[model samples]
Target: MARISTKSLTNRASWLVLRRNRIMTIGETVGILRDNDDFLVVTHIRPDGDTIGSASALCYALRKIGKTAYLYNNPQFGDSYPWLAEPYLAPEGFEPKYTVCVDMADKGLYPEGFKGSADLCIDHHPSNSLYAKNTLLWPHKASCGEIVMELVKELCGLDAEVSELLYVAVSTDTGCFVYGNTTGETLNAASELCFAGARNAFLNKILFRTSSKARLALEAQILSSFLYYHDGKTVISVVTKEMLEKAGANEKDCQDIAALPGRAEGAFTSVTIKEIDENSCKISFRTNGLVDANKVCAMFGGGGHKMASGCTIKMNSFKAADTLADIIGEEYK
Candidate 1:
């Protein structure tokens, strides 16, 4: 794959912004939310805590302000954080007058069979494609949850439940405040959420402190077979469909598995290539201020923050691993 120059990438992003989206400030976003009603909040496919938490918090905030809101029933939604989302799910035959997307960077991330563009997008990804009509993007923020937290504060004030949901959004994206993306603002938002009753102790125990036995087994398998390149600066882990079955792990157990390889002492970049099927694989790229994970994943038509990004390759797991290794190796060279 050809590398994209910074200038070219900027131009591409600028073109996309000029084509459709209107970038808005946090205050502007709040104003729009206040003006809207009957909202249907959407999350990306394969929803993670950040997306789910952000969407749920925003949905809950909208409702608190006397607006009708519901979360789009994402089919891929796992049972990870049911309490945050279950009550806000859109019911059958529900018609939304407006659509809002949380934590989604591009239209490619939209749920299966989702039609039309988002009326508003709240996100914190530098690589956001600006697919929404109005966007509130804070790339400097660690998580979209932070942006949503500010919006919620302005909309209806942060209640305990909203605070807890936003805390999950912020903490998960920052790896419970351990990822390189965590910043002063990230910590401050977490502190405020804690003051508002985020249940950090319980959330921490569940989200970070504890891991299922199946997850441990899966980690052991990954550790035993990690592929190192560039003198161990880069590590690649492949998770096959068979591995999940053998470990008794489901998709939920595989959450944050990409961070495992990065734990290696000398590894600066970690790539997780998960076999989706025989024809395609999902790639998660994480970096520690070395190579740009976003740029690498963007080469494969995927983009996210500089430290973490992901893409899906239309290739078998092994082949995709080799392909990503080659690209990342070139970055090191």
Candidate 2:
């Protein structure tokens, strides 16, 4: 969690200049789109709020302009996101001349069936491999939703659908605006979405509402599995195969319980380990400040932003715990 030095900033900036997107500015993106007539929208495998918001917002805008755009993602995404409108459509034999990746840099993140070149990538992640003919990687932007908001304003102005989609993208990426990434620009854009009829009540009722019996039982189990250290400065928990099965829990239920440990007093990081199977585990890392989870994630062949990031460990449960602890311990050194 060490702050990036001046040298690091210089390096990142130079890299940006060599392969920056001129259409990152709203005016430029709109001009490019107005002339183009085909697009295929795609996102990372486990689509989050930013992915859902950006893909729907951009696809909807494209359709508004009389262009045809198709959407596709891993099937597991549908299971995790029941509240969404299922904007991704993939009819058999459907194809597009160009594909658009939203909120992601690498096409490999799209799971097995979705592997190929994308014509464009609208993303804010630094790990992006520039896997598109045209790309926009804005680390300073709070979310891909923010980038799409810029596009919405420039292309056709904000409408009701655009407002709702953009709101979900921004709110979720910022952790309800409580995270460090929220900025004045994000707030202003959110306000515009509100004015265009984005309803907070409707979004929350669906996103947070628990309807599964397994989910309730899993929550109870997670509440009791807590372990603390350093005067409660660190909180850790594990969800093993046995624990999950006894609770009738599934991977979708694991998502919500992952962030609970950061609630502990004096804690800088909350680590949640969920056994994806007997040999592999998914790790969710959340930090209040000064603990870069992305560094830990990178060690496991995964990458994301600093404060809220994730990684997958291919080792068994015991080795996974040791690996996580060691990586986090290095941050303290």
Candidate 3:
């Protein structure tokens, strides 16, 4: 592994507070990327569009500059993102000099058996834990892809492939530009990526407009069981293992289900409880700028972006659902 020297940095290490984590300016992050060459990039466990796209864009940009880079082939990478994920999976037994995580904030989300090994981390989650030796985090940014896009531009310039990957990263995390986290800068980044030949129309169609029948059935079940609290400001939706089995839904069907109830007229906060097993569930929280979803999830030892976040609970699904809703209701008060 190449050593990182403070002397190589053009600017001093400037740290600013972001939700208990110290964040770096883009310039300082760029300095680290410029100094390093061999990189093994990893993403969070369920590997969302932001993680996959950011890792892919970074690897492509580094290779463009004649640097060695690879992405771990996580099994959770589904067929939906082959263009962005297929070409970059590192070969088995490949030894990486530096391990870098993209769009991953919490160590709990790290790949199995690979804990506390991140040399560097890039993320946009406000609740990011400073787990990496060098963390390039900007919680105010809508997506980590936004940060990665700028870094790629500064380092190797954006090609169409990188642009497409980054577009995936930004668009998916921002709910296709409709979520509360979508800022002017987020749209500006999207515009630049489109100009750089991202197939925006095609990406939007596949990522947002299309869904499988199983997903639709799951949505119907969740809607049937949906409940509101605190005068409809807090909405709760659940998908139990039984519901999934009955609906014939796969894991892919549950994508973005957490944000569904928030689209209702009077909902200020939404929670989705997904029962992974009889004794364990994952809770996803979405808010409309009223409540801090991160804080709510943190109550259960989970964290993520403010508008969207999640935590896992080791209780039965029904109990976890009631517990999370009660906590969110209390926080609203």
Candidate number with greatest TM-score: 1
Candidate 3 residue-wise lDDT, 54-147, digit = tens: 9999999888888889988777887337568889888878788888899998777886555448778898887776777777877889999999
The 10-residue segment with the lowest total lDDT in model 1:
1-10
What ranking of all candidate models by lDDT puts the best one first? 1, 3, 2
Q: How far off is model 1, as Cα RMSD? A: 3.9
Which regions in candidate 2 have their CA more than 4 angstroms from the true location? 1-24, 82-88, 209-211
Candidate 2's residue-wise lDDT over 113-230, tens digit each?
Answer: 8866777778887666665767766767778898888887777788887888888888878766766678898888788888988986677566555447887887777768777654
TM-score of each: 0.94, 0.87, 0.90
How would you order the candidates by TM-score, starting with the best? 1, 3, 2
Task: Go through the candidates in order and give the C-alpha RMSD of each one to the true structure.
Answer: 3.9, 4.1, 5.2
Among all candidates shown, the one with the greatest lDDT: 1
For all candidates in order, the CA lDDT equals: 0.88, 0.73, 0.83
Instruction: Tell me the spans in candidate 3 whose CA falls farther than 4 Å from its real position.
Output: 1-23, 113-116
Q: Give model 2's TM-score versus the native structure.
A: 0.87
| Pairs of residues at least 3 apart in sequence or in different chains that clash in candidate 1 | none
